[model samples]
Target: MIEVKNVSMSFRISQDRIQSIKEYLVALIKGKLKYKDFWALRDVSFSVHPGEVLGIIGHNGAGKSTVLKVISGILKPTSGSVSVHGNIVPMLELGSGFDFDLTGRENIFLNGAILGYSRKFLNEKYDDIVAFSELGEFIEMPIRNYSSGMLMRLAFSIATVVNPEILIVDEILAVGDESFQRKSRQRMMELMSGGTTVLFVSHSLEQIREMCDRVLWLDHGQVKMIGEAQEVCDAYQI
Candidate 1:
């Protein structure tokens, strides 16, 4: 189960960066360049059952990704609370925990370790991960040489290797090709069928409607509506 109550996140963003030492001194003295607080999420509350698939949808800067980040424990909410039960696998960013200097094969073990998986467990899943990623020859090469799509494939393959109890996914499916997206969708369906709780954030409304059991529509960091997939998505489309 996952519960997010009155979750709000605020960030202090610098308005502008001084280009040179002179500019910095002038700005510092004049207070021309300052920071402003931007609230990404505000008073958003929701819950997900053990086997439910919840889809979060909105436009750019709508706080859709903020909700997932809070749930994944990547970003702390400025206010309110987020509680998640069971093991979680978050596919929020591709190449986030990766080392560009390390080979894909080495990073697999490294990533598995980060995820609290034993060497034995990673060993058992190594071949499958490589196969699924379809980066056979390149898996032995440094990750710095990999393309964005290739990186997404590897990340998705590793993140989904284990059937986690809770899965939090952002718009990572947008990076891969059509074939890989289809493959990833199939894997997600398998996980959902296994009764895993899923929190998905995507701009693709069609995909959200097709895969999600329930949908939460967010606008400007606020919960606009939350209900059945069709109804919420229908309203969001407007």
Candidate 2:
């Protein structure tokens, strides 16, 4: 289960200073700062049960990604609390955990470790990851040499193979070709059938209708509606 209670987040911007002495004095005495307060999320609360597929829909800059970040524990809420049970695999930004200077094979180990997999676990699944990525010869090459699509493929493959209890996907399906997309969608279906909870964030309404059991519509960091996928999508269209 996952519960988000009255969560909100904000950021502070600091002014630039020229002199070191002046900077130190300002830091000590004045400490003048301005807050933009983007309010990526504000008093938003929701809950997801095990094996539930919850789709988040919103316009650009509607705090969709922010909610995912908060749920994934990558960003702390300025106010309120978010509690999640069981392990989570967040496929938010592709290649987020990779080292550009390292080879793709090396980055696989790094990413798998970040996902809490043991070396033995990764070793057993290494071939599956490489095969899914379809970057056979390129796997040994540095990730920096690979294209953006290749990087996304490698990252997505690693993240999904872990079979986390809670999966959070954010626009990662937009990567790769038609065949890869089909395979990915099939993999997601398999996970859902296995009773894994999924939180999906995507702009594709059709895909949401096909994959998600429920949908939440958000606007300006607030929930506009939450219910059946068809109903929320209809409301979102208007």
Candidate 3:
């Protein structure tokens, strides 16, 4: 289960754009770095029980992603508390862990290790990951040469090879070509039904309504509504 209570997050961002490192350094030394408090999330609270699929919906910068980051332990709320039970696999910002200098083959181990997969586990699943990625001969090439779709495909394959008790996804189903997208959706459904708690954020209301058991709607960094998927989605559309 995931429990979040009275969560508020604040970031102090520079009011003026510093175009260069030298300018930033000068401003810092002169104590002239103008900053403003930006509240990304305000008193957001919710919970997802095991085997539940909870979808988060909001406009950009409405704190959908921020809430997920807090739950994944990627960011700390400036106030309040978050508790997550069981292992978590976060697919937010897919391919963010890659080394462009390395071959796809090499990064299977490199990126897998970053996700806390044991080397022995990667070794056993390496072939399966390669096949699922459909990279074929390109797996031997440096990742820098890969197209964006190819890169995301590899990342998705590596990340989804093992199912975790909790899955956090942010528009990840849009990763690849149409055929791969269908396959990815099927895989996601399997994971969801396998007793994994899923926290998903997507712009596709149709997809959300279809896959999610419940929806949380945020407007301006606060919970606007939380209810059945169809109910909240209907209100969000109107």
Candidate 4:
């Protein structure tokens, strides 16, 4: 289960670009540092039950990604509270944890460890990850030489290896080739059917209507509406 109650997140952004650390230091010491408080989320409240699929939809800057990051423990809210019970696997910004200088074989362990898997676990699952990525002999090469698709495929392969208790995905389904996209979708469906609670953020209304049980619409940084997928989607369309 996932519960987010009156969660609010804020950041203090510099009003002026200082251009250099020396300039920044000068401004800081001179009490000339201009700043503004940007609230990414404001009094946002929602909950997801075990095995439920909830879709978050909004325009750019509507705080969709910020809220996800908060729930994933990537950011702490300025106020309010978030409670989650389960093993969470976040698929936001695929390959965000990879080292381009590292070979694909080396990065599997590196990225796997970032995802909370131990050395022993990664060692055991190494072959399966390589096979799923279909990188074959290329896995030995530095990932810096890999195409964008190759990089994302390797990251996706390593991330979805475990049956997570809670899955957090952010518009990552369109990975790799068409065949691979279909395969990834099937894998997601398998996880959903296996009773994994999911928090999915996507711009595709069709995907939300088809795959989600409920939808939450965010306007600016607040909850504009939340209801059945079709209902919220239709309301959003209008």
Candidate 5:
């Protein structure tokens, strides 16, 4: 289960900058400084029960990603609190945990380690990961040389293999070709069948309707609606 209470996040940006070190010193002496504040999320609250697939939809800069970031513990909420129960596997940005300089084989181990998998566990699952990625011989080469699709494939394979109690997917299936998209969808369904709670964020209403049990609409950093997938989508369209 996941519970979010009155969550809010804000970012501060410097509005005025010093031209040089001397100017910075003078500004400090004069006590003249400027900044601007932007709130990405405000009083956002929601919950996900076990074995639920919750889809989130919103326009650009509507705090969809910000909400996911807070859930994943990447960014701390400036106000309120988010509490998650169980192991969480966040597939937010593809290849975000990988080391570009390392080989695909090496990165597999590195990523697994970051997810708390031991070297022995990774070694046992190595073949499954390699087969899912379909990089074949390229798996031995450095990940920097792999195409974006290849990197995404590898990342997805590793993330889904462990069957985490909670899965957070953010716009990952939007990449790759039609066939890969189908495979990704199938993998997600398999995870759902295992009773994993899934928090899915995507722009494709069709995909959300087909895959999610419920949908939540977020607009301007607030929950606009939540209900059955089609019902919320219909309300959102209105």
Candidate 6:
């Protein structure tokens, strides 16, 4: 289960765009520095039960992704609280734990380590990870030579191989070709069937309707709606 209660996050952004470090230092010393308070989220609250699938949807700059980051523990909320009751696997970005200089084979271990998997556990699952990625011979090549699609495939494979208790996905499904997207969706289905809690963020309302049991709609950092997937999606679409 996961709960986010009255969570708010704010950042102090420079009001004036300083061109260089020297300019910034001069502004600092001259007491002419200016900042603006930007609130990414405010008083957002929601809950997801174990084995539930919750989809988050919003327009650009609407704080949808920020909510996921807070739940994934990447960003701490400025106020309120978040509680997660299981091991979390967050697929927030491409190549998050990958080393471009390392071969795919090596980065598999590296990525697995970042996910808190033991060496023995990774060794046992290594073949499955490679096979899922379908990099084949390219697995021996440095990741820097791989395309964006290849990086996404590898990242998804590693993140899902161990069946994390809670999976946080943020528009990562939009990567790769149609075929890869289908495969990724099927894998997510399998994980969901196995009782994994899923928190998904996507602009694809159709995908959200198909995959989510519930949906949360955010607008300007506030909870605009939270209810059944179809109801929320239909309302949002209108």
lDDT of 1 by residue, 61-174 (tens): 999887887888889999999998898987777556798999999999888788767899899999999999999999999999999889889988888888888988886664
TM-score of each: 0.87, 0.88, 0.91, 0.93, 0.90, 0.92
Q: Which candidate would rank higher by TM-score, 3 or 6?
A: 6
Candidate 4's residue-wise lDDT over 1-238, tens digit each? 8999999999888888779999999999999999999999999999998999999999999999999999999999999999999989998978877998999999998999899888988889999999989999999999999999899899999988888899999998878999989887888778777888989999999989999999999988999999999999999999
Q: How does residue 149 of candidate 2 score in lDDT?
A: 76
Model 5 CA deviation exceeding 4 Å by range: 16-32
- By lDDT, the better pick of 4 and 6 is 4
Q: Give me the runs in candidate 6 sitting further than 4 Å from their true place.
A: 17-25
Candidate 6 per-residue C-alpha lDDT over 116-220 given as tens digits, one digit per residue, 9 for 90 to 100: 788999999999999999889999999999998898899888888988889888877755689988898888779877888999999999889999999999999
- C-alpha lDDT values of all predictions: 0.87, 0.87, 0.92, 0.92, 0.87, 0.90
lDDT of candidate 2 over 144-184, digit per residue (tens): 98887788789888988877899998877746788888887
Scored by Cα lDDT, where does model 3 land?
0.92
Count of backbone clashes, every candidate in sequence: 0, 0, 0, 0, 0, 0
Residue pairs with backbone atoms closer than 3 Å in model 6 (clashes): none
231, model 2: CA deviation in Å?
1.3
Which of the two, 2 or 3, has more TM-score? 3
Rank order (by TM-score, best first): 4, 6, 3, 5, 2, 1
Summed over model 3, clashes come to: 0
Poorest lDDT segment (10 consecutive residues) of candidate 5: 11-20
Ranking by lDDT: 3, 4, 6, 1, 5, 2
